[model samples]
Structures are given as structure tokens and as C-alpha cells.
Target: MGRWGPRLITLGVVIALVYPTLGDPPRDGFPLSTYPMFAVDRGPVTRVTTAVGRDADSDRVLLSPHLLAGTDEPIMAVRTARTAVSDGRSAEWCREVADRVARGPARVDGVETIEVVTETHEAAATLTSDAPPVSVALHATCPVSRR
Candidate 1:
């Protein structure tokens, strides 16, 4: 191999590594990542669809991803909730969550009802400062049947 052989190989490797960065964020996926942390502009506020439990006093307890979608993956749970709301099946989803709360562990101890909702919030603010959502869209609500 000549001096140019190593140089050519290095150039080829560099090009290969950088090629995926050229694609748009949504398309920059598959075997290679688009690195949405750096590429996607999440903006200031984000709308998240989720399930929550409310006791008789109206205190809200954010349900876990498992209770929401029967999976521990948050993204999957979010997708499940979003799909249910868009498909006009939020009541069914709410009932599903309510049943989970009634039968699952004691974290949701006094929860009396389940609600499927979408809330618009500034990133991390709703959690860090305990800030309320800028807006809330209630998709469905149902009672928790304690057996």
C-alpha cells in the first residue's frame, strides 16, 4: 500500500460516518441515528398525551407508562395514548388504565378515576417548577372499579 492508500481509507471512513448527518432529522434514522437531541428542534413547548388518575378530591397522579400501555417504554406508551385519542377510543383507553390502577400496586392508592388527556407544557418546567399545563385537552374519563 502507498501513502495515499491510508489517506484514501481515512477519507472514505470519514465520509461514511458523516453521510447520515446529511439527511433530515425525520429521515435520519435506521441503522444510523439522526441524533434528534441535536437535530430536532423541539421548540419551547411540547404537547404530551398521557393518562392520569384522579381521586375523589380531584388530586391528579400521573400514571406510569406500564399502566398506560402495558409496556415500560415511555415512547410506546405515548404513541398508544396518542393513537387512542386520535382514533376516538380514549374512553376505552381510560377504562383500561382505570382497571390497571384498581388492580396494580399501591402507588395510585386512592385514585378513583382515570383520565386520558393531552397537555401543552414548556419543557421540564411542568416537572421542575411544578408548573401547570398551558392548556389541557381531556379526551376521556372513567371510574376505577375496585374489585
Candidate 2:
């Protein structure tokens, strides 16, 4: 049984890793997740959330994962993009993200310009607030593509 035991364990591990990928839409978890940062809820509390775009009138415009990154991972992309921008490579990251946004099928419409900002909110408090955002840090901007 010793000889077969090791091989059986190896086969089981492989199956577990591949199982999530075998789904119709390819779910992620356990040993096959791309990354599982927020696999579970963190509970209600004050938190800072990063936002992707602002309109020409300087109004907040919501962005989806696919629109910002062409992937179902805005959090990961936001972290990477912020790092790139903060490291004095804003031009490069801006162009890359802008291109990805432009090529996305569900791109935000009617926005002539785009900027990344961070907003802080308290989850326990009421959603309505007359006060300004706790902070508004602009990280990058790109002109909307005419295409």
C-alpha cells in the first residue's frame, strides 16, 4: 500500500486543483484560486475604497472590474495600478489602463476624461452624507478614446 499511497495522494491533489477550473464558467477557490484576498466578508466597518474614474464635470463615475481591467478583478488591478502610479510611472500605467478600458466591451460611456481616486466611508454610519469624502487622492488620468 505504501507505493500506491503516494501516487494516490498526488492524484488527489491534482484533481482538487483542477476541479475549480472544470466548471462551466471556471470558479476559483482552495488550491486553484488565482488569488483569494476577499474570499469571505470582513464585516461592517470603516474602510477606504479605491475608485477608478471621474467625469469631465468632476462627478464620480462607477467602474466595473471588466471595464477597468478587462478581467473580473478590480481590486488586484487597482493595487497594481496604484503601485505603478505611485512609483513615478503614472504615464505608463495610465496609458495601459486607458487602453484596456477603451478596448473593454462595457466601457463607461459619455466620459471624456478619467481619473483614479480613493474614497473613505464608514459602513456603520448612514449612507447619506453631506460631508465631503474623507480623502480624494487623484492617482492618474487619461483622455477618453474617441474610438
Candidate 3:
């Protein structure tokens, strides 16, 4: 009975760990997990208003939104393209998206920089805001490896 006790406990622990993964897709699915590592410090996230405006002369679309970083101070903006880190075509797509965002208007006063840290085809951007140094992560899905 002594040996069996430990074995049963070990089995219980192993099952607890595997059960969560079995029921759902991995955390980084097409729709990523809400409980990401970076969202911890973002206090009271009020959804920013966004507008998709068209540049008639350039034939381009712009995405303008106001993001409120926890504090009253201005936050540093980080923009990423989906294809930049992954595949070549995706990188081009991401660049287009980034370009559109760059041209878009921002209501908040101090948006220091809009950097493309990683190209498309790679992981999403993990941005750290300046106001209170809050971290926000953007996630995207890619093919899972069989091997």
C-alpha cells in the first residue's frame, strides 16, 4: 500500500497537467489565449476607437486608433507586420499593414515610435508601453510541426 500511494499521487499529478492540453488547442491558436504573460500590468484597458480611412490619392487604407496605456502619460507605440517573421509573402503583407497604420492618425499626443521589431512569418509583437512600462503582446497562429 505504501508504494501504491506514491504511484497514485504521481498519476494524479500527471493527469492534471495533461488534461488541460487535451481538451483545448495550444495557448497560441488562431484565437490566442486571453491569459497571456504580457497582459498582467495593463490596468483597466479601455478599448481605443479605430477608424479605417482611405487615402484617395495614394489608394491606401489607414488604421487610426487611440490606445490608453494604464497611466495618464503618453505610451510608446509598437507596430508589427504579421508576415515579417514567418514567410516571405506574409512579411510583405505585414509591411503593408504597418505602412497603413503608420500613415493613420493618432489622437494621443506623445506616440514616440512605431517600430517593426520582427517581420512577418515570425511571432507577434510584444510591446512595452512607456507611461508605466506596461507590456502588451500580440499573438498570431502558424502551422504546427509534426516532427
Each candidate structure's TM-score, on Cα atoms with residue i matched to residue i, is 0.73, 0.54, 0.24
In candidate 2, clashing pairs total 0
**What are the runs in model 1 whose C-alpha is more than 4 Å off?**
1-38
The per-prediction tally of clashing pairs is 0, 0, 15
Candidate 1: give the clashing pairs. none
How well is each residue in 53-126 modelled by candidate 1, as lDDT tens digits? 99889998888889899989999999999999999999988998888888888988889988888999986898
Considering every candidate listed, which one attains the maximal lDDT?
1
Q: Candidate 3, residues 36-129: lDDT per residue as tens digits? A: 4475554443222112223324332332323211122322122123323334343343334344444434531122223222222212122333
Instruction: Please state the error at residue 87 of candidate 3 in Å.
Output: 29
TM for candidate 3 is 0.24
Residue 35 accuracy (lDDT) in model 1: 61
Full-model lDDT for every candidate: 0.87, 0.63, 0.34
Model 1 superposed RMSD (Cα):
3.6
Root-mean-square deviation of every model: 3.6, 7.8, 14.9
lDDT of 2 by residue, 72-108 (tens): 8967767765676567776566666566656654546
